[model samples]
Target: MVASRSQVADVAANAFRRSCLMARISTKEELRRIIAEPRPATRVKILDSLDEQSIEFLKRCPFALVGTTSADGTVEVSPKGDEPGFIRVEDPKTLLIPERVGNNLAFGLNNILDTGEIGIIALVPATGETLRISGTAEIHDDPELVASLSSLGKPALLATRVRIKHCYFHCARSIVRAKLWDPKAWPAPGRISFGKIIAPRIGESEAVAAQIDANVEGAYTTRLWQNT
Candidate 1:
């Protein structure tokens, strides 16, 4: 007997992406069964655009993670950070994010160029709450605008203007569980070095590690303030 069309589609949808992670929660029923439903208050938090509270929250956030996707399905989450209020909220429905200097992977920016879909979560220091913003992104190359949002005498090459569709404050549960701001909870010092990380790739010896570390610090001191 042939399976019905719905059953066939269900079978196709349930296919696992990786064999090792095959114990997948493929169906909505499977997902929901393990997680409790959200309260009505949680549902009501989503907003069509930024409101006064959200605007203030954004003003306090000096760091944010932006998620974007390429047309080919590659996903990236890039961090954009500077002074607080670096991300300009031009109006209730508009947001301007300064694109600063970096490693030049440009994953998030390139994805924005490709598909325009963007999701952002703005965070303040030692704060558990985060502001989530989702919308389409449009790149702006006006030098004056870039300069206006500049930091430490350096200007962005461009800004990504987000036309807000949904904005909300994400709850603090995850942050709380992680004890993000607790100095006591932080891992002990002697953290891994970037020099050690790149040494293997660069085929460098212990003597070169110090040179690499110096180069990294010099780059941060010099190029960090250069025009993006």
Candidate 2:
């Protein structure tokens, strides 16, 4: 007797589940078996400090993702952006990121205080390549240093200084694959309703959510450079 359509569907679903379970490699050896090793040149490309090329790259980079970890090993990543070259390369071995107006949660900042380690991936708009740097970091509030990192005629309240330990240019394959700079291939933008997210969790009404969203948008426009 021929299998019914439902039986056939059930068989296929079970096969997919089995394949997924079998595809997971739990050991490094199993992982290495399927993935090729990096080329020797790739292995040696990490640098201890920023080179001339790296410094020039920073001159055009306006955005970066900063990564930090807390004492309990929780990780936090924060996005920072400003005019090109907003991040100052204090020297070949050091760099600084000024703190700007933001929500006071301070998860990433507090993580930096708990664990001095930091990693950053700096990117330039419309460019596929990115620069990756990992190093030790310290939060600084020196008046002169903070003033030097200012933007829009307003000095930064604090700066995170990184002592570079490893620096490298990441290949552009990931960006190319994601089509990040290709506006033609982009999907429609989606709205982020912070009020909808927060209000429901707190058992608040739609009116409260609307008020929260209005406050968020107001802050975005008025408080970017300084607190309103």
Candidate 3:
């Protein structure tokens, strides 16, 4: 006899669960054993400071992601962007990020305050290579430093200083695989209702989404670019 839809669904779900369980590589030792170490060229790419090559790469990059973790081990990532050369290579070992106005949640900033550890992944458009920087961070609110990195007549409220511990030029394999800069490979953009996702966490889930959506539209049209 043919299986009913409910029976078929049950069988499919069980198979998926089994596949997921079997596919997980359970431990770091297991992962290390399966993957070979980096080749000499790859190994040599890691450096202690911003070399001339790395400095040039960063000067050309307009965007980067900041990764940080709180003392409690909560992790957060925030995106930073501006015109090319927005990030200043203050010295061979230090880099500065101008803290512009954002959502004001300050998740990334608070993490830096709590733990002082930070990571950076800087990317340039149309270039498959990326720069990765791992460092200890401190927040600087000095007027001179903030004014030095101003954008559009508004100085940054603060600046984030990263004293590099290790930095590297990451190869292009990941970017090439993702086809990140190829417009032809991109999916059509869609509107996202972020409010719908958060509504259930706060109060009555029904009206919250609409209220948040309206607030978002208002901000986007009026207040979004006011600070920057």
Best by TM-score: 2
Give one digit per residue, the lDDT tens place, for model 2 in 189-211. 97789999999999999999999
Candidate 1 least-lDDT 10 residues: 12-21
TM-score of each: 0.83, 0.88, 0.82
Between candidates 1 and 3, the TM-score winner: 1
Residue 204 CA displacement from its true place in model 3, Å: 7.0
Q: By TM-score, how accurate is candidate 3? A: 0.82
Q: In model 3, how large is the Cα lDDT of residue 140?
A: 96
Clash pairs, candidate 2, are none
Which digits, one per residue and each the tens of the lDDT, describe model 1 over residues 90-114? Answer: 9999999998877778888889989
Best by lDDT: 2
Question: In model 2, which regions exceed 4 Å deviation?
Answer: 1-23
After superposition, the stretches of candidate 1 with alpha carbons farther than 4 Å from their true spots are 1-22, 189-192
Model 3: lDDT equals 0.90
Clashing pairs in 3: none
Tell me model 1's lDDT, rounded to 2 decimals.
0.87
lDDT of residue 15 for candidate 3: 100
Candidate 3 Cα errors over 4 Å, as ranges: 1-29, 198-211, 226-228
